[model samples]
Target: MINSVSIVPDFFQRVKTISFPEVIRVFYDEEPRRSKIHCPFHEEKTPSFHIYENGFFCFSCGEKGDSIDFIVKLYNLRPINAAKLIAERFGLPVSNGPLSRQDMLRLARAKAERLREKRLKEAFDNWARLAGQQVRILAEAIRLQLEEKGLDIEEDLLPLVHELPRLEWWANILAEGTGEEKLELFRNKDFRRWFTCKN
Candidate 1:
Protein backbone atom coordinates (compact mmCIF):
# COMPACT_ATOMS: atom_id res chain seq x y z
CA MET A 1 0.00 0.00 0.00
CA ILE A 2 1.10 3.51 -0.68
CA ASN A 3 2.11 5.65 2.27
CA SER A 4 -0.62 7.94 3.62
CA VAL A 5 1.58 10.98 3.17
CA SER A 6 4.38 10.80 0.65
CA ILE A 7 6.30 13.68 2.23
CA VAL A 8 7.19 13.17 5.86
CA PRO A 9 7.41 16.42 7.80
CA ASP A 10 10.52 15.37 9.74
CA PHE A 11 12.30 14.43 6.52
CA PHE A 12 11.32 17.74 4.96
CA GLN A 13 12.52 19.57 8.04
CA ARG A 14 15.88 17.83 7.87
CA VAL A 15 16.17 18.63 4.18
CA LYS A 16 15.29 22.25 4.89
CA THR A 17 18.16 22.50 7.38
CA ILE A 18 20.69 22.00 4.58
CA SER A 19 21.61 25.31 3.01
CA PHE A 20 20.03 25.73 -0.43
CA PRO A 21 23.14 27.59 -1.63
CA GLU A 22 25.31 24.60 -0.71
CA VAL A 23 23.22 22.24 -2.80
CA ILE A 24 23.22 24.70 -5.70
CA ARG A 25 27.00 24.98 -5.50
CA VAL A 26 27.26 21.24 -6.23
CA PHE A 27 25.61 21.72 -9.67
CA TYR A 28 26.41 25.32 -10.65
CA ASP A 29 29.81 26.81 -11.51
CA GLU A 30 29.00 30.22 -10.02
CA GLU A 31 28.73 31.03 -6.30
CA PRO A 32 25.09 30.84 -5.14
CA ARG A 33 24.93 33.88 -2.87
CA ARG A 34 22.78 36.39 -4.81
CA SER A 35 24.56 35.12 -7.92
CA LYS A 36 22.79 34.63 -11.24
CA ILE A 37 22.86 31.27 -13.01
CA HIS A 38 20.85 29.84 -15.88
CA CYS A 39 17.55 28.45 -14.66
CA PRO A 40 17.88 24.71 -14.33
CA PHE A 41 14.17 24.30 -15.14
CA HIS A 42 14.19 26.14 -18.47
CA GLU A 43 16.55 27.09 -21.29
CA GLU A 44 17.70 30.69 -21.44
CA LYS A 45 20.79 32.56 -22.74
CA THR A 46 21.02 34.89 -19.74
CA PRO A 47 21.29 33.75 -16.13
CA SER A 48 17.89 34.60 -14.69
CA PHE A 49 17.93 32.20 -11.72
CA HIS A 50 18.88 33.83 -8.44
CA ILE A 51 19.79 31.95 -5.28
CA TYR A 52 18.91 33.32 -1.87
CA GLU A 53 19.92 32.14 1.60
CA ASN A 54 16.63 30.29 2.07
CA GLY A 55 15.85 29.15 -1.47
CA PHE A 56 16.01 29.90 -5.18
CA PHE A 57 13.85 31.91 -7.59
CA CYS A 58 13.95 32.07 -11.39
CA PHE A 59 13.03 35.49 -12.74
CA SER A 60 12.42 34.22 -16.25
CA CYS A 61 10.03 31.39 -15.42
CA GLY A 62 8.67 32.67 -12.13
CA GLU A 63 9.73 29.42 -10.50
CA LYS A 64 10.22 29.82 -6.79
CA GLY A 65 10.69 27.05 -4.23
CA ASP A 66 12.60 25.93 -1.18
CA SER A 67 15.52 23.45 -0.92
CA ILE A 68 13.36 20.30 -1.03
CA ASP A 69 11.39 21.66 -3.96
CA PHE A 70 14.63 22.51 -5.77
CA ILE A 71 15.92 18.97 -5.39
CA VAL A 72 12.62 17.47 -6.46
CA LYS A 73 12.36 19.67 -9.58
CA LEU A 74 16.07 19.52 -10.49
CA TYR A 75 16.38 15.74 -10.24
CA ASN A 76 12.82 14.82 -11.26
CA LEU A 77 12.45 12.79 -8.10
CA ARG A 78 9.39 11.94 -6.00
CA PRO A 79 8.93 13.86 -2.77
CA ILE A 80 10.07 10.95 -0.60
CA ASN A 81 12.97 10.09 -2.88
CA ALA A 82 14.09 13.71 -3.00
CA ALA A 83 13.88 13.98 0.78
CA LYS A 84 15.85 10.78 1.18
CA LEU A 85 18.47 12.00 -1.32
CA ILE A 86 18.86 15.22 0.59
CA ALA A 87 19.11 13.39 3.91
CA GLU A 88 21.69 10.97 2.55
CA ARG A 89 23.75 13.80 1.03
CA PHE A 90 23.70 15.76 4.30
CA GLY A 91 24.29 12.72 6.59
CA LEU A 92 20.86 13.02 8.19
CA PRO A 93 18.58 10.19 9.35
CA VAL A 94 16.16 8.96 6.70
CA SER A 95 13.16 7.50 8.54
CA ASN A 96 10.52 9.95 9.73
CA GLY A 97 7.91 7.35 10.71
CA PRO A 98 7.91 3.89 12.25
CA LEU A 99 7.59 0.93 9.89
CA SER A 100 5.16 -1.84 10.68
CA ARG A 101 5.82 -5.46 9.74
CA GLN A 102 3.24 -5.21 6.98
CA ASP A 103 4.97 -2.14 5.52
CA MET A 104 8.30 -3.97 5.60
CA LEU A 105 6.80 -6.97 3.79
CA ARG A 106 5.10 -4.73 1.26
CA LEU A 107 8.35 -2.92 0.54
CA ALA A 108 10.20 -6.20 0.19
CA ARG A 109 7.57 -7.60 -2.15
CA ALA A 110 7.62 -4.48 -4.29
CA LYS A 111 11.40 -4.60 -4.58
CA ALA A 112 11.33 -8.28 -5.50
CA GLU A 113 8.61 -7.72 -8.12
CA ARG A 114 10.62 -4.89 -9.68
CA LEU A 115 13.71 -7.09 -9.85
CA ARG A 116 11.76 -9.95 -11.39
CA GLU A 117 10.20 -7.67 -14.02
CA LYS A 118 13.60 -6.26 -14.91
CA ARG A 119 15.10 -9.74 -15.33
CA LEU A 120 12.16 -10.91 -17.44
CA LYS A 121 12.44 -7.82 -19.69
CA GLU A 122 16.18 -8.41 -20.17
CA ALA A 123 15.56 -12.07 -21.06
CA PHE A 124 12.84 -11.15 -23.56
CA ASP A 125 15.08 -8.52 -25.23
CA ASN A 126 17.96 -10.98 -25.56
CA TRP A 127 15.68 -13.62 -27.10
CA ALA A 128 14.20 -10.98 -29.46
CA ARG A 129 17.66 -10.04 -30.77
CA LEU A 130 18.50 -13.70 -31.41
CA ALA A 131 15.09 -14.30 -32.98
CA GLY A 132 15.60 -11.29 -35.32
CA GLN A 133 18.89 -12.77 -36.55
CA GLN A 134 17.23 -16.12 -37.16
CA VAL A 135 14.37 -14.42 -39.04
CA ARG A 136 16.86 -12.62 -41.31
CA ILE A 137 18.50 -15.96 -42.15
CA LEU A 138 15.07 -17.48 -42.92
CA ALA A 139 14.14 -14.50 -45.12
CA GLU A 140 17.35 -14.87 -47.11
CA ALA A 141 16.69 -18.60 -47.60
CA ILE A 142 13.11 -17.86 -48.71
CA ARG A 143 14.31 -15.21 -51.13
CA LEU A 144 16.78 -17.68 -52.68
CA GLN A 145 14.03 -20.31 -53.04
CA LEU A 146 11.67 -17.76 -54.66
CA GLU A 147 14.41 -16.68 -57.11
CA GLU A 148 15.06 -20.33 -58.06
CA LYS A 149 11.32 -20.73 -58.82
CA GLY A 150 11.19 -17.44 -60.76
CA LEU A 151 8.61 -16.16 -58.20
CA ASP A 152 8.30 -12.90 -56.27
CA ILE A 153 8.79 -13.01 -52.49
CA GLU A 154 6.07 -11.43 -50.36
CA GLU A 155 7.14 -8.87 -47.72
CA ASP A 156 4.22 -9.75 -45.41
CA LEU A 157 5.37 -13.38 -45.18
CA LEU A 158 8.52 -12.34 -43.29
CA PRO A 159 6.58 -11.24 -40.20
CA LEU A 160 4.39 -14.39 -40.22
CA VAL A 161 7.49 -16.57 -40.54
CA HIS A 162 9.27 -14.70 -37.76
CA GLU A 163 6.40 -14.95 -35.22
CA LEU A 164 6.86 -18.68 -34.63
CA PRO A 165 10.47 -18.70 -33.42
CA ARG A 166 9.91 -15.45 -31.46
CA LEU A 167 6.90 -16.88 -29.64
CA GLU A 168 8.65 -20.21 -28.98
CA TRP A 169 11.74 -18.46 -27.67
CA TRP A 170 9.64 -16.11 -25.53
CA ALA A 171 7.65 -19.05 -24.11
CA ASN A 172 10.80 -21.06 -23.32
CA ILE A 173 12.41 -18.14 -21.54
CA LEU A 174 9.24 -17.36 -19.58
CA ALA A 175 8.83 -21.06 -18.62
CA GLU A 176 11.92 -21.04 -16.40
CA GLY A 177 10.30 -21.09 -12.89
CA THR A 178 7.50 -18.86 -14.17
CA GLY A 179 4.58 -21.36 -14.17
CA GLU A 180 3.01 -24.38 -15.88
CA GLU A 181 0.85 -22.14 -18.10
CA LYS A 182 3.80 -21.02 -20.22
CA LEU A 183 4.99 -24.61 -20.58
CA GLU A 184 1.47 -25.71 -21.53
CA LEU A 185 1.22 -22.93 -24.10
CA PHE A 186 4.57 -23.97 -25.54
CA ARG A 187 3.33 -27.56 -25.88
CA ASN A 188 0.04 -26.67 -27.60
CA LYS A 189 -0.49 -28.44 -30.99
CA ASP A 190 -1.35 -25.21 -32.86
CA PHE A 191 1.77 -23.51 -31.55
CA ARG A 192 3.83 -26.55 -32.54
CA ARG A 193 2.28 -26.49 -36.01
CA TRP A 194 3.14 -22.82 -36.38
CA PHE A 195 6.70 -23.48 -35.22
CA THR A 196 7.15 -26.25 -37.82
CA CYS A 197 5.36 -24.49 -40.74
CA LYS A 198 7.51 -24.05 -43.86
CA ASN A 199 5.17 -21.51 -45.56
Candidate 2:
Protein backbone atom coordinates (compact mmCIF):
# COMPACT_ATOMS: atom_id res chain seq x y z
CA MET A 1 0.00 0.00 0.00
CA ILE A 2 1.17 3.53 -0.81
CA ASN A 3 0.19 6.93 0.62
CA SER A 4 -0.43 9.68 -1.94
CA VAL A 5 0.60 13.22 -0.91
CA SER A 6 2.85 15.99 -2.13
CA ILE A 7 6.11 16.28 -0.14
CA VAL A 8 8.00 19.45 0.79
CA PRO A 9 11.80 19.87 0.48
CA ASP A 10 12.12 19.62 4.27
CA PHE A 11 10.34 16.26 4.27
CA PHE A 12 12.55 15.06 1.42
CA GLN A 13 15.68 16.17 3.27
CA ARG A 14 14.64 14.26 6.40
CA VAL A 15 13.95 11.06 4.45
CA LYS A 16 17.26 11.38 2.59
CA THR A 17 19.16 10.82 5.84
CA ILE A 18 18.26 7.12 5.80
CA SER A 19 21.39 5.23 4.79
CA PHE A 20 21.17 3.11 1.60
CA PRO A 21 23.71 0.50 2.74
CA GLU A 22 21.74 -0.24 5.92
CA VAL A 23 18.36 -0.24 4.15
CA ILE A 24 19.47 -2.82 1.59
CA ARG A 25 20.20 -5.27 4.42
CA VAL A 26 16.47 -5.40 5.17
CA PHE A 27 16.11 -7.56 2.00
CA TYR A 28 19.61 -9.03 1.71
CA ASP A 29 21.26 -10.90 4.57
CA GLU A 30 24.65 -9.74 3.32
CA GLU A 31 25.89 -6.35 4.36
CA PRO A 32 25.73 -3.97 1.40
CA ARG A 33 29.15 -2.45 1.90
CA ARG A 34 30.87 -5.78 2.46
CA SER A 35 29.15 -7.65 -0.35
CA LYS A 36 28.38 -6.23 -3.76
CA ILE A 37 25.30 -7.45 -5.59
CA HIS A 38 24.42 -7.82 -9.28
CA CYS A 39 23.16 -4.62 -10.87
CA PRO A 40 19.41 -4.29 -10.28
CA PHE A 41 19.13 -1.91 -13.23
CA HIS A 42 21.20 -3.85 -15.77
CA GLU A 43 21.88 -7.51 -16.65
CA GLU A 44 25.29 -8.16 -15.10
CA LYS A 45 26.69 -11.41 -13.72
CA THR A 46 29.49 -9.85 -11.71
CA PRO A 47 28.28 -7.56 -8.94
CA SER A 48 28.69 -3.91 -9.97
CA PHE A 49 26.04 -2.24 -7.79
CA HIS A 50 27.45 -0.61 -4.70
CA ILE A 51 25.52 0.76 -1.75
CA TYR A 52 26.87 3.64 0.35
CA GLU A 53 25.74 5.63 3.34
CA ASN A 54 24.30 8.50 1.28
CA GLY A 55 23.45 6.66 -1.94
CA PHE A 56 24.06 3.75 -4.33
CA PHE A 57 25.45 3.38 -7.84
CA CYS A 58 25.45 0.74 -10.56
CA PHE A 59 28.68 0.89 -12.53
CA SER A 60 27.25 -1.22 -15.33
CA CYS A 61 24.17 0.93 -16.03
CA GLY A 62 25.37 4.23 -14.56
CA GLU A 63 22.20 4.28 -12.39
CA LYS A 64 22.82 6.30 -9.26
CA GLY A 65 20.82 8.11 -6.61
CA ASP A 66 20.16 8.43 -2.88
CA SER A 67 18.01 6.11 -0.70
CA ILE A 68 14.77 7.89 -1.68
CA ASP A 69 15.59 7.50 -5.33
CA PHE A 70 16.31 3.80 -4.73
CA ILE A 71 12.80 3.28 -3.40
CA VAL A 72 11.28 5.50 -6.10
CA LYS A 73 12.85 3.49 -8.93
CA LEU A 74 12.48 0.08 -7.24
CA TYR A 75 8.73 0.42 -6.62
CA ASN A 76 7.95 2.57 -9.68
CA LEU A 77 6.26 5.02 -7.32
CA ARG A 78 6.26 8.80 -7.02
CA PRO A 79 8.84 10.49 -4.75
CA ILE A 80 6.32 11.44 -2.04
CA ASN A 81 4.86 7.92 -1.85
CA ALA A 82 8.34 6.41 -1.68
CA ALA A 83 9.28 8.83 1.07
CA LYS A 84 6.15 8.01 3.05
CA LEU A 85 6.80 4.29 2.72
CA ILE A 86 10.43 4.63 3.83
CA ALA A 87 9.50 6.84 6.76
CA GLU A 88 6.74 4.47 7.91
CA ARG A 89 9.09 1.51 7.57
CA PHE A 90 11.52 3.27 9.95
CA GLY A 91 8.75 4.33 12.38
CA LEU A 92 9.02 8.00 11.53
CA PRO A 93 5.68 9.81 11.86
CA VAL A 94 4.63 11.99 8.95
CA SER A 95 1.70 14.38 9.26
CA ASN A 96 -1.05 13.95 6.68
CA GLY A 97 -0.05 16.67 4.23
CA PRO A 98 0.90 20.31 3.83
CA LEU A 99 -1.53 22.76 2.22
CA SER A 100 0.57 25.86 1.50
CA ARG A 101 3.93 27.51 2.24
CA GLN A 102 2.53 29.46 5.22
CA ASP A 103 0.79 26.33 6.51
CA MET A 104 4.02 24.34 6.20
CA LEU A 105 5.93 27.03 8.10
CA ARG A 106 3.31 26.99 10.88
CA LEU A 107 3.46 23.19 11.09
CA ALA A 108 7.26 23.24 11.28
CA ARG A 109 7.20 25.81 14.08
CA ALA A 110 4.63 23.79 16.04
CA LYS A 111 6.71 20.63 15.65
CA ALA A 112 9.82 22.45 16.91
CA GLU A 113 7.90 23.77 19.94
CA ARG A 114 6.61 20.27 20.75
CA LEU A 115 10.18 18.89 20.62
CA ARG A 116 11.41 21.72 22.85
CA GLU A 117 8.70 21.06 25.44
CA LYS A 118 9.41 17.31 25.41
CA ARG A 119 13.13 17.92 26.06
CA LEU A 120 12.37 20.41 28.86
CA LYS A 121 10.04 17.99 30.61
CA GLU A 122 12.63 15.19 30.38
CA ALA A 123 15.40 17.43 31.75
CA PHE A 124 13.19 18.64 34.61
CA ASP A 125 12.22 15.09 35.55
CA ASN A 126 15.87 13.99 35.65
CA TRP A 127 16.86 17.02 37.74
CA ALA A 128 14.05 16.36 40.22
CA ARG A 129 15.11 12.73 40.72
CA LEU A 130 18.77 13.70 41.25
CA ALA A 131 17.87 16.66 43.52
CA GLY A 132 15.78 14.45 45.82
CA GLN A 133 18.65 11.96 46.22
CA GLN A 134 21.35 14.65 46.61
CA VAL A 135 19.57 16.64 49.37
CA ARG A 136 19.04 13.46 51.43
CA ILE A 137 22.70 12.41 51.05
CA LEU A 138 23.93 15.85 52.10
CA ALA A 139 21.60 15.88 55.13
CA GLU A 140 22.82 12.41 56.20
CA ALA A 141 26.45 13.53 55.86
CA ILE A 142 25.73 16.63 57.96
CA ARG A 143 23.92 14.54 60.58
CA LEU A 144 26.92 12.18 60.90
CA GLN A 145 29.26 15.15 61.34
CA LEU A 146 26.88 16.61 63.92
CA GLU A 147 26.98 13.30 65.86
CA GLU A 148 30.80 13.25 65.77
CA LYS A 149 31.16 16.87 67.02
CA GLY A 150 28.34 16.96 69.61
CA LEU A 151 26.97 20.54 70.36
CA ASP A 152 30.18 22.15 69.00
CA ILE A 153 29.42 21.48 65.30
CA GLU A 154 31.83 22.76 62.61
CA GLU A 155 31.11 26.40 61.71
CA ASP A 156 30.76 25.45 58.02
CA LEU A 157 28.19 22.69 58.76
CA LEU A 158 26.19 24.62 61.39
CA PRO A 159 24.37 26.51 58.62
CA LEU A 160 23.35 23.19 57.00
CA VAL A 161 22.36 21.78 60.38
CA HIS A 162 20.17 24.84 60.91
CA GLU A 163 18.70 24.41 57.42
CA LEU A 164 18.09 20.61 57.73
CA PRO A 165 14.32 21.04 58.27
CA ARG A 166 14.05 23.26 55.17
CA LEU A 167 16.19 20.77 53.24
CA GLU A 168 13.76 18.00 54.18
CA TRP A 169 10.89 20.19 52.97
CA TRP A 170 12.74 20.81 49.73
CA ALA A 171 13.32 17.07 49.30
CA ASN A 172 9.60 16.42 49.70
CA ILE A 173 8.85 19.10 47.10
CA LEU A 174 11.36 17.57 44.69
CA ALA A 175 9.71 14.17 45.15
CA GLU A 176 6.04 15.12 44.87
CA GLY A 177 5.62 18.85 44.24
CA THR A 178 3.70 20.42 41.36
CA GLY A 179 5.63 22.09 38.51
CA GLU A 180 4.85 25.57 39.89
CA GLU A 181 6.15 24.52 43.33
CA LYS A 182 9.38 23.26 41.76
CA LEU A 183 9.71 26.47 39.79
CA GLU A 184 9.28 28.55 42.97
CA LEU A 185 11.94 26.47 44.76
CA PHE A 186 14.37 27.19 41.91
CA ARG A 187 13.53 30.90 42.19
CA ASN A 188 14.36 30.95 45.95
CA LYS A 189 17.89 32.32 46.49
CA ASP A 190 18.59 30.10 49.52
CA PHE A 191 17.60 26.94 47.72
CA ARG A 192 19.65 27.96 44.66
CA ARG A 193 22.75 28.68 46.76
CA TRP A 194 22.47 25.47 48.81
CA PHE A 195 21.75 23.29 45.73
CA THR A 196 24.70 24.75 43.81
CA CYS A 197 27.08 24.48 46.76
CA LYS A 198 26.09 20.90 47.63
CA ASN A 199 26.31 19.86 43.97
Reference-based TM-score of each model: 0.43, 0.45
Residue by residue across 124-170, what tens digits does model 2's lDDT show?
77877787788888877887888899888878778789888888889
Task: State in Å the error of residue 3, model 1.
Answer: 9.4
lDDT of 2: 0.72
For candidate 1, what's the RMSD? 14.8
lDDT of 1 at 120: 76
TM-score: which candidate is best? 2
In Å, residue 32's CA in model 1 sits off its true spot by: 3.8
Looking at model 2, residue 94 earns an lDDT score of 60
Report clashes for each candidate as comma-separated counts: 0, 0
lDDT of each: 0.63, 0.72
